[model samples]
Target: MWRCALPPLPRYPTVDELGARAAALVARHPRDARLRRVGTSRAGTPLWLLSVGHGSRQALVVAGPHANEPVGGATVLRLAERALADPRLCEGADATWNLLLCLDPDGARRNEAWLSGPYTLGNYFRHFFRPGFLEQPEWLPEGADGATLPETRALLDLQDELRPFLQCSLHGVDVGGAFLELTRELPGIAQRVARTANRLGIPRELGPYDTLYWPTLGPAVYRIPPPRRGDLAAAITEAAVESTWFHPHPYGTVTAVVEAPMWGVAAVEDPTPPADADAALRTVSHTLRDDTRLLEEILARVRPLLGCSPDVARLLAPVDDYLLVGPGLADSWDPDLRQGGTRPLPPLTVARLTALRLAGRRVALRTAGLLHQLVTASGHDPRGVLPELDRLIDEWCADYRDGCGARWIPVARQVEYQARVVLAVFDLAERDARVRSRSGETGWGSPAAVPMHRE
Candidate 1:
């Protein structure tokens, strides 16, 4: 087995640094690996694709298309290293696989500083605020002039050229527990994937946890709704049609955008865990393998079912609501912490509530902490928590509408906002309980804590 020396974990890396690291890795393992500069970012950073493996005809294309979600980038890098060292992983596969590690170097680099340091819940919270272009790297194929971004253009070019059987776009979510999204229907794969997670002691949940779980593509192949229009899921289906020019392949390409929760992968605790790189690596390895197996199973079962005649557009639809929201809350609760300064109350409130429920803080203390966070961070009045939360939500929506300049802001914001709102609610509940206890009205036991939604 060829084991490359593991680089020490840093909080983050600059865009240039990330590019250098990627280039070096490609250079060091050139025998089975080749690096291609697919395109340049809006910021003019070169987006590179690293490919490793012998020619097997069938290809598995995985890209960490988002900037904030670096776990996919890490996972891809690890996979590349593993593929170079272990011939079996590539050998056993029936088809050739070309994995595109990161498609958004500019966005990826904007948040690189956070990746280099010791992993922390606070660090994760802080990393999300850095603003990149409005267009998601993954969705850029549709483009700026309604055309793809440079990165997306590169992927599209490769997709047109290689016409691989499977494409897995790597992404990470903050709130949901871990789950898999499939392009085509795979009857028994979700259970198997869940089982793998359970075996690895990774937290797993099924069904849409929040709005983020909703469909970005067409209909739900594995879950619900047949399919829809627009988004990556839709775009990939469109791309598949052009596959005819590239090859006379028997099966149409099965493209999946896999989203794994960052917290689950890193095993982030409510109170937070001490940094442990080995444990983090183990978690990632298990997750990648579990996901890979699930994908392989789905491909094996569905390849025969895919046909060009009656286009399986519905087969490529999203199964869950992509918006992440709580029962009674809007989705714009938290401030994008990457902008620095004290982030508003929503995320802090949620953190306190989660800490109290999961980390075993006393209700009174949790409530007090919630109040403290709100008062200190958001400059909101402690006495009017509900009104403050409501106002914050309204302000956030207005800001989002103004900033996005689009009809609809991305649904992931809902999940982000909901997490913040729920945290605040939990914190407030804890605080209320404390007040009730002091006044001697013991009516309710405690608020039932709900798990963050994931699809």
Candidate 2:
């Protein structure tokens, strides 16, 4: 982490509050900070990019890439404030900082109800909103629907214009612990991140998550998986063409995707291998299938009444994807084996499996809640299905609470952990640049051939 200290944030901000903070930075440092209207959201909200410093190289920091993961919004504002106040931050990194306040303002606005939070599990799901994969700005496949979201176009435009050597996208999870995905393996940085989380008493997420399939560099650190055309229909894969794959540089841009959990669960931190490994996998798989069927039945009842509401469709896409894709992709895993017939999974694998199972339950409950919201918003008497959905949501929520014993992580700590990881990545980039300079190679994309693991 850098010398500048970030005070813990009390709460996540709304999209407008994030914008206001960005504007305040420009006001405070008018000579150094330049706020640009890069593009407009689908809702016609102006998207702002706050550019600070005039270093020879450039670094892009994107917050709110996933709407519900708003911790990054506060993280971005704080980092911008620090960059403006302490010019050495950009000077040391030798890169200009371009911070995008929020990528998906439309989706972020939908989640505003929970942003200023009491920070409870129930309160979060009640107002939660995640767009369908296609509806997402950066992840949407090229020409899949013959159109691109304005927000996505803006991102592409910015990438082309800036051609940053380093990019960090801020993201977080609802529960579990913190994890990171890096495009290029930077030695010592991942260990530093783990140490930072440990120092803050935040357990590194060892469980299965969206990027479970990616290659691991160390504990809670992963190399981002390359895009595959075949993964398009997979429920767990989410998108075949992720935002990280669109770098403009020829060699490669070092991209870091930081995921901090809002709630901490002990189950995911345990590294002890499970005894009945096959049975555990089977149970997780079985529960996912059963829940998918249950949600399918619920959606069937309201399919006719909803009248093709795009918002409802987007809201239900995750559940729908699970139902359509079968017990494959996101939900399926084979046991590890040696020359011996079969081996017990590693402790981290077991923890991930447990987390994945519990995550399925959360997805089911969230889907039910969204369904109830849709029915009520449509002016229909939802009593017919809501009572059942409510009961399921309550029972599943209870199961989630009891199963994982997840504790609400304070927003302040979450921001601090994220900020530390970002700064670590920045420091790694700076160190790599110096190494390249010493080696007489001044290319933007070619990071010095640093070892993947270095203490």
| TM-scores of the models, in the order given | 0.50, 0.88
Report the Cα lDDT for residue 168, model 2.
90
Strongest candidate by lDDT: 2
Q: Model 1, clash count?
A: 48
Clashing pairs in 2: 207-352, 208-352
Write model 1 residue lDDT over 335-433, tens digit each, in one string. 221234533222222222232122111111122222223233434342444343344334333322342121211223322222222222222333443
**Lowest lDDT 10-mer window, candidate 1?**
319-328
Q: Give the TM-score of candidate 1.
A: 0.50
Query: Would you list the C-alpha lDDT of every candidate in the order shown?
Result: 0.40, 0.73
In model 2, what lDDT does residue 204 have? 84
